[model samples]
Target: MTTKNLPIYQIDAFSDVLFAGNPAAVVPLSTWLPDDVLQKIAMENNLSETAFFVPVTAGNADFHIRWFTPTVEVPLCGHATLASAYVIFNQLGFEGDIVRLQSKSGILTARRYLGAIVLDFPKQPIVPETIADDVIAALGGDTPVETFGVASRDTDLVAVYDDATIVRSMTPDMSLLAKLADRGVIVTAPGDKTGLDMISRYFVPAIGINEDPVTGYMHCVVAPYWADKLGQDDVVGYQASARGGVVACKVVGDRVHLTGEAVLYLKGEITVSA
Candidate 1:
């Protein structure tokens, strides 16, 4: 078999500092490759998400994008989308300020906003759910202030807390949570510190991520929820995982503007054969 050298980059999204935020692998391609190869590269990179993009010729968007986790292909991902936009604007030497991507979730736009890169994503409809016992038990016995179901997934649920400390100190049973109906349990609370309105942590061990450092996609649901609670459209969210990250958000009708900083971590080449 022949090998093709592909340029790849690993970027830490939603943080200005290195080693913070979530790291995603970005692979820009001129043509589409086999799905198996794309999945293989994601597994090889071993990150929570690897983003692949091919420039689109049609009108609605600038490029076609896809996201893959170590185990499955997620419908939408925020950090990886941010990473992809970073590549397009800074590394690829594009002069434009915005990059629109057509994704499985729909058309998502990433632009430079107030010195931070921003991603415009569809807001998920949040509906109150009957909190389950296992959901509370997964968080080590701290019952959330409330819980809701997100339109993003049939099994995705959002749990709100009263304070940030509860979110930071949570040590959920990843194994148990994985088996629970909520495939992605988003635990969030009001930010305790200055310059932050909210804080959150994401656990989706069933899809192979136990705790996502800074979840960009989850914020689509979170931003709207907080905007309603805070009675404001602009808000700041800090994901207090081991590797912390800050995402600035603005809730627009049916959309959320997700903004954050990212630092380039590694640029390397990967060899693949079809």
Candidate 2:
């Protein structure tokens, strides 16, 4: 059988500029695409992630959403959710003022607030842990004085370095990173150059992304950790990834709210063989 045609939208999430923020391919479908096909599409697109959406009605509200990377399906993705909401609200001309996503993680809601999109996500608090030799080798850094694992997946490794430059300048070994058991590693330090509370860089070679341009999920854990340390709930975050982006973060109860703007970059279609 011939493959059906699929529509795809490339959107830059968490930034207003075309090149800034994370670029995610949004594909809205009537039914869920096969996992293999989705991965193939993501690999073909070669973006950090590609989001797939399908409508679901539960109890009182109707929801739509799903997220995928080139290699695997993820439980949650902040930037892609922002990109999906952007497409639903602006491109599809969705009438509702808010969009709710029923994802593998749970129900997540996004709404327009003060010209920026705000996403309410679960707060992931991780306690500091002993740094392993392999983790340090993957990061290409001497053993950090302190380390923390964020969330249950242990995808985020918060390593505190002495200076911001040390965190920014170090070149990591992706091959070694892929061998790491965690989903991703995050190296961070107090920002000396900027007035922001802190600056960080995220690498996820294990999941097929060498470095994520801007990571909203990591901030879910970072925002809370830094908030308590700095005695402030609201703060700014800078992802030191090559194609970096900024995020405004706030911690509310058990949830962390991340707000940012997204820009539409490329629009195209995909033809998938059956």
Candidate 3:
């Protein structure tokens, strides 16, 4: 078997400080690899997500990006995309302020903004939905103020609470959550701290992450939700995880812009059989 070495970078996204945010492993590829190989690599890394990208030649985008958790490939991932852009701009010497990436979700752009990376992603609008009783029970029996489901995907559900404290104190039953029809649940509330407009916690046991530290894509749903509730188009969100991080969000007509910082934690190589 032919073996090849691939460069990988572990980055702490949504935080300038190391070990404080969601860490994602990024592998820059010159060409596409097999799906099983990508999944295996992601599993080996054992992070929340691993990102792979190859330079694009005949499209409006600079590269094609994909994301994988340990168990499955996901449609959209925010932190890993930010990490991939960081590697491109800072490591690969890409001389541009904006990096356009085409993915399963469509065209996504990462721009250098005010000392942070701003990610322009499609807003995942949600509508009211009846949440399963077991799902609510798994969340410690505190019912949500409102429940919503993403119109674009069947795997996402949003639970709105009245206070940030409820969101922070949740200790969910992962087995019950994994059995739900929706694969991921996002619990959000009005921010309690200064300078923050919203707070959120993400749980996706079906995707192999019990609780994501500082989720980017989940913000796509929460940002618009909070903006409408607060009557402000721009707001800041804090993910109340063990290793918490902040994300600044701006909701436009049909898009959500997320801004955060990423710091490189490790740069190394992985050998894969080809």
Candidate 4:
């Protein structure tokens, strides 16, 4: 097996501190790596997801990027996207403040806005639906006072709780959560403790994730739901996961804009075996 030095960086997105938000590994590569190699790197990093960026053109503005989890590849991921942007802008010595990423989903742009990185993402809207028994079981038997279903680029389950604390304090059965197929669950409520407008937690055990530390993809659905519920297009959301994260969100027509900060944790090199 041959080896090459691969640059990697660990970044905490949606948080200003070292360990608060989701930690993702960003690997900037010169060319596309083999699928097995990418998966193995993600598994070795053992983070929620790792991002790989390949330069589309030398010193050009855009690059092709892909994200992979230890188990599978994801279409879209917010924290890792943010982490990738942080690396391109701060570490790679790119001249421009804004960078464009061409992903499996589509083109995404990130820029520094209002002292934070604002990401413009496609909006996922929710329609009312009945809750499945398994969903209720996974939620620890606390029947949602109201349930709304949303299918955007991804499937989302939005369950409203009485308050934020209950959403935060929930202990779900991961075994039952594993039964859910290809859908992400969100338990959310109006915030009483935090200054934020609402708080929520995300679970995606079906895709081999028990609990996402900070979910930006879930926010795509959450922002629009609460925007209508709260009668305001702009909102502040707090993900109550153990690591926790904060997102400043706004609903703009059929799109949602999420803004937050990120901190780079580690920078190193990897030798990919060939």
Candidate 5:
């Protein structure tokens, strides 16, 4: 068994202030560990997502990234990716304006934009779908104005309500939701609050996450929808979880620009033998 003390960091993503955004754990490694060990670390951290990345020598990307939820490795995770970029830029002293993450979802890049980090992620293609009765029942019996299926690394369902107020007031039955989908369920609506174009709440009980405070990857799917609905390519969104956050979105062709801020929360080391 290999025993090592690995440096780790917890970061609050998609929020300028502490305690308002999603908190993700970041582990930077010189080499990749066994997949089971990585999953154990993520499970131990007990956060929504834990990101693992290693510096690469032969690729155009400076680093290769992976994301793990408690139960499985996810194809894409936005907040953790942002947290990883923050670590590379601030902690590792990365000199470049952009850090490209070679991930399972492909090359996801993060760059500085007006002092905030903007993540360039591919937009998920959305298709209109009818919500099942059980799915509607899972969401507190409030039938959404529209429902769509978004396909990417994971298949997710987006339920659009009439306004943000409805989104904020939701208290869905997570147990019932778990039976409906094997992925995420994003409930969203046009933003009712000032300086916000949309608001959303994410529930992913199927993947062991009940509610995500701020989901940047979700906007990659919903941003284009809102852009077309609002008749603008640039928009702002807020995730109305108990710990809220803001995400800046710009739809450009097949890709979506997801911009947000991340703040350092805690830095430490984990001693493990694998």
Candidate 6:
């Protein structure tokens, strides 16, 4: 039996310290592999997300990146993308401060900002909508002051609470979240803490994550929404998960720039049968 050794790096994204943010596995592939193999690798890692990237000679893009959870391949993942950019800058000897990756969500770019990585993502449009009774019940039965439907991959429901405490104290029903079919739930509120503009928590059981410690994609949706609601373009958001993290967001036109720091946690090799 022949085997191949692949380089893998585990990184904690959206936090400068270890074990404080979302951990994502990043595998640098020389070429594209089978989709099933990628899924299997992600499943083996068992993290919220695993990122795979291959160098490309395409226009204005350094690589093509893809993200997968334990169960399925997701269209967009902010933490994993930030982790991949960290690898490119720190491990791969990339010279430029800006790294552009082409993904299913369109061309995403990561740049250095004050010793942190800033991600450029499209602002997910969220519109006020009626939420189902069961979904509300799944959110601990405390009705949200507002419910909005998200127009983005992975995230579907956005529930706005009047207080940050309610967003932080939610004990959601994972079984109900799993029924959302690849969609995730987001709960957010105005920040009561100093230095924070908003707070949020993400539940995405449908895509294999019951609770994401720090979700950048969720901030992309919430930051813009809060910007419009609060009449500010720049906002600081904190994810009140057990492994809490902070995201600095700036909304410009149709784009949202997310800034956060990542730390490398583990560097190892995975042996896969060829």
The number of the candidate with the highest lDDT is 3
- List, residue by residue over 116-216, the lDDT tens digit for candidate 6: 99999988888878878888888889888998888665248889999898888899889976884347888999999899999999988887889999988
Name the candidate that leads on TM-score.
3
lDDT of each: 0.89, 0.82, 0.93, 0.85, 0.90, 0.91
The TM-scores, one per candidate, come to: 0.96, 0.94, 0.98, 0.93, 0.97, 0.97
Distance from true location, Cα of 150 in model 5, Å:
0.9
Residue 97 C-alpha lDDT in model 1: 87
For model 6, name the residue pairs that clash. none
Alpha-carbon error at 203 in model 5, in Å? 0.4
Clashes of each: 0, 0, 0, 0, 0, 0
What's the ranking of the predictions by TM-score, best on top? 3, 5, 6, 1, 2, 4
Ranking by lDDT: 3, 6, 5, 1, 4, 2
Model 4, 23-60: lDDT tens digits are 99999988887899999999899888899988877443
Model 5 clash number: 0
**What is the C-alpha lDDT profile of model 1 across 80-194, one tens digit per residue?**
9999898888899978888889989989988887767988899988788966897688777887878898866878888898978889999998998888754788889998999
Clashes of 3: 0
Task: State how far residue 99 of model 6 sits from its true place (Å).
Answer: 0.6
Candidates 2 and 6 compared: the better one by lDDT is 6
Q: Is candidate 1 or candidate 2 better by TM-score?
A: 1
What would you estimate as the lDDT of candidate 4?
0.85
Alpha-carbon shift of residue 3 in model 2 (angstroms): 3.0
* lDDT tens readout by residue for model 5, 1-274: 9899999999999989888899999999999999999999999999999999999898779999999999899888899999999999999999999998898889999998786899999888888877688987888888799998886534688899997778899998898888887788899999897899998999999888999888878888888999999999999988899999889899998998999999999999999898
User: For residues 137-249, could you state the per-residue lDDT of candidate 3 as single tens digits?
Assistant: 99878989899998887768889999899999999999888887457899999999899999999999988999999999999999998899889999999999999999999
**Poorly placed runs, candidate 3 (over 4 Å):** none
